[model samples]
Target: MSDEPDETPRLDVPVGMFEDIEDLKSQLAQLTALVEARTGGDSAETVEAVSADEEEPAGGDAEGEEEEWQYPPFILLLDPPEYDDELRGLIEWVEGVLVPGYLGEPSADAKWCHRWFEHSVAIARLHAAWLAWQELTNPVSCGNTGPSVWHRDHLDPALRELRGAAGPFAGCTKGEHRVEHRLPSLVPSAWTHEDGA
Candidate 1:
């Protein structure tokens, strides 16, 4: 060995690793397409349809040009949980905007409420828990008893209900081990009906 240390970092991937990754990606895309086709719903098409339903034609003569599709307002609040300012903003938006807006609408099916992971109500609750988690884990904030208070008052109870055996994803799994489960959307009819009545 030479006295001089090597400065460059080396990747020791197998020669065929890149090709294997590409093949896996291709398989995933195909599987995604298959699932979309089976469900009779594509995200792009759904957005387009929702836009068409909500928009008014500017003029009858403008039909020659394609209309720009706009996503539903709920899409903005459907992001996965995060740990930064984005999570704080999402918590505020969900609490101040989404919760109130959803409450004003007709009540959702109780049967479908079991599917908490797929529902807006559950998302809002989960966001609240994530916010609490941030406060509890922060070394400089929320006091020393913050974590205890959060667990006793918020996180434990919420998680107990949300992840219980009788919870929304009850049919999806029996315990902690993940199994193949076909979870319908929060709206039963939306997933069941191709016309989306």
Candidate 2:
């Protein structure tokens, strides 16, 4: 067993298996906004580092060779012993599986664990939000509005992003892990609106 300390982040909202329709819509909207925010608003992280060779200096320099391209800074993800081995792999994984997937990429090659981890995080967030929304909107859990519900759309973009990076994950159907309980279906086609037009 890998003693990864929860290798996942907790969601900030509560969720329900069967939520009211309006509340469900609300949850969907929330998911949409959150995903849109996390995905860096449509731009994507590049894939250069993942494919780079050892002799290929961080950049081309006569000191090896080339021009410089700058990227904005953000918090780094890992902080372990081997910065190169552990860190670069994570950056690539995030770039490949998690980041690309959430940013609305339209493929599906991200591995199963990647898909599973991202979905679970979103679910946890939805549930957390549901809890908070309930407190503010329907305090006391009055007669008609027990607890607000969650929508799956909010989580769809991330899956799409992952799909674009990797492609359809093969073991996605297996159901023998804790994370499986939290995955939202990745079938975007199934939610298309009707009018037959």
Using TM-score as the measure, which candidate wins?
A: 1
C-alpha TM-score for every candidate: 0.30, 0.18
Candidate 2 residue spans exceeding 4 A from truth: 1-61, 64-158, 161-166, 175-197
Candidate 1: global Cα-lDDT?
0.52
Q: lDDT tens string, model 2, 29-117? A: 55444444445444332123223434465646653342222121111322344424543444454556445644443223543443443
Best by lDDT: 1
Report the C-alpha lDDT of model 1 over 69-179, residue by residue, as the tens digit: 312213335445433445456557546644464333222221223234354445556667656765565534444666788778776666555555554434443223222
Cα displacement (angstroms), candidate 2, residue 168, comes to 3.8
lDDT of 2: 0.41
What TM-score does candidate 2 get on C-alpha atoms? 0.18
Worst 10 residues of 1 by lDDT: 105-114
